[model samples]
Target: MSKIQAKDVNGVRVLILNRPEKRNAIDLEMYTQLTEYLIQGNSDNDIRAFMIQGQADCFTAGNDLTDFLKHTDIDPQHPAFRFLFTLLDITKPIVAAVAGAAVGIGTTLLLHCDLVYADKSAKFQLPFVHLALVPEAASSLLLAQTVGPKKAAELLLLGDSFDAETANKLNLINDILPSDSLFDFALDQATKLASLPPQALQASRRLMRGNIDGIRLQMHAELEEFSTRLKSDEAKTRFHAFLNKKSHKPT
Candidate 1:
């Protein structure tokens, strides 16, 4: 079965992350699938908006470390980077419903979303620093811009997990909803966007996002350092430790 599944409701394209076994940890194939779906959805006139969600217990555990470690190159055209870049260029509005864990790019991806709703069970974290790495998805720039440098520093530097309430307080999410109703609520919002005037909505969204060029530059800067750090001894050691921890976990 496909790790990423898509369904159309009215004019909204709903993308479901379906790797519950892996806690929906995105791999290279999943990234490619996501990029293709988003690009296809944006161009299809029948699809006006998008909604991204995962299983009741997880939004995503972040990337698949085994798969990520296998890739020595981290260029702009890399599948993971392509997915992030696709998020930046998508014209249609994207809404996200997050529950359980949203780690690393899982949380950063929310920054590019137009609306985000999380359940009380949701947990957000940026553990790049903990892994001896820098931020990606232009999160270093956007997070600082959204919540100010001080709070951004607190979250990124400490690399700690935070709850849904804190995410709402930081304006990272629109609001927290009951876990049972979270998916329906987020889908409703996306459907509402699909019901609006597409041109006007797209124009308003673009105006609000301001300079795309600046965001692109920030992503490039982050990727350059991210690639370098991926090669470092500290990062390699942490990666090995993480793999070991996972291997020893009681199932």
Candidate 2:
């Protein structure tokens, strides 16, 4: 079965991260596939909106550490960067349904979504600092804009996991729901968006977002810093330590 699954429901194109065995951790191929699906959905007139979700137990554990460690050539054209840019460029309304762990990019990517629903059990974290790297997905700027600079610093610098209540309070998520109903609620919200007048919806969305050029600039800046940090000796040490720890864990 495909690690990333795409289907249309109620005019909403649903993209599911399907690698449950890996906690839906994204790899290069998954990033490529996701970007392609988003591009296809954005161009398809019949698809009015998009919804992203994972299995009931996990939204995503973030990037697959093994895959990330193997990819040394980080650049603007990298698949991960491509995915981030594609997500940022997508014009249609995007909704995210999050449950369980949403680590690293999993949490940051929600900033690009129009609406985000999380289960009460959902855990969100930005562990770039823990990995001895920096934030990506324009999160350094955007998170500060969303939750003020002090809180953003705490989140990024501390690299601690937070619960859904904290996420909602930080404005990262629209609401928190029961774990069993999170996906359905998010999909329903997406369907509602799909049913709205397209031009007006898109126009309002664009207006609400405001200053795309600024966001693009911030993203590029973040990418540059992130790429540089990824190559640092500290990051290499942390990555090796993390991988070794994972390898020794009981299955």
Candidate 3:
């Protein structure tokens, strides 16, 4: 079965993260799938908008550490980078339904979405500092722009998890819905967007987002730093410690 499941509702392309056992942790393969789906949806005229979701209990646990540990050296062609860049380039409106954990890239990816709806079960964290790495997805630039430098510093520097309510206050989410209804609510919103006049809808979206050249530049800078950090001794130690902790978990 595909880790990233694709479905269509009306004109909306819905992508679901399907690795429930891993709490929907994104691996390289999943990243590639996500990129392909977004690229496909963006180019297909029939697909008016895109919706990203996961199981009601989990949006995503973030990247799979096992994959990260094995593939530390990265470039623009890397699956993770390709996925991030795809999110930036896609012109169609993207709506996200986030239920449980949105960690690392999980949280960063939402910054690019046109709309984000979450549930009380949602938990968000940057954790790049904790992992001895730098932020990617242009989060270092966008987070501060979204929530101010002080708050962004707290989120990125401290590397702690915040609840859905807190995320709402930070303007990270449109609203919090009951977990049972979050998916339907997000889908409804995506369908509404899909129903709108396509050219106008896309044009309005592009205008609202303003220039993305800066975002693209920031992503390239982040990629360079992320690649350097991934090869660092500190990052290696942190990754090892993290994996060791997980392996010793009482399972």
- Give model 3's TM-score versus the native structure: 0.99
> How well is each residue in 107-215 modelled by candidate 3, as lDDT tens digits?
9999999999999999999999899999999999999999999999999999999999999999999999987889999999999999999999989999998769998
Question: How many clashing residue pairs are found in candidate 3?
Answer: 0
List the lowest-lDDT window of 10 residues for candidate 2.
68-77
By lDDT rank, best first, the candidates go: 1, 3, 2
Per TM-score, what order, best first? Answer: 1, 3, 2
For candidate 2, lDDT tens digit of each residue in 1-251? 99999999999999999999999999999999999999999999999999999888899999987887789678878999999999889999999999898999999999999999999879999999999888999999899999999999999999899999999999999999988788899999999999999999999999998888899899899888888888889999999999899889999
Which lDDT values do the candidates have, in the order given?
A: 0.96, 0.93, 0.94
- Assess candidate 2 and give its lDDT: 0.93
Question: For residue 236, what is the lDDT in candidate 2?
Answer: 92
Query: Least lDDT summed over 10 consecutive residues: which range in candidate 3?
Result: 202-211
Q: Write the per-residue lDDT of candidate 1 for residues 25-97, one digit (tens) a residue.
A: 9999999999999999999999999999999999999989899799959999999999999999999999999
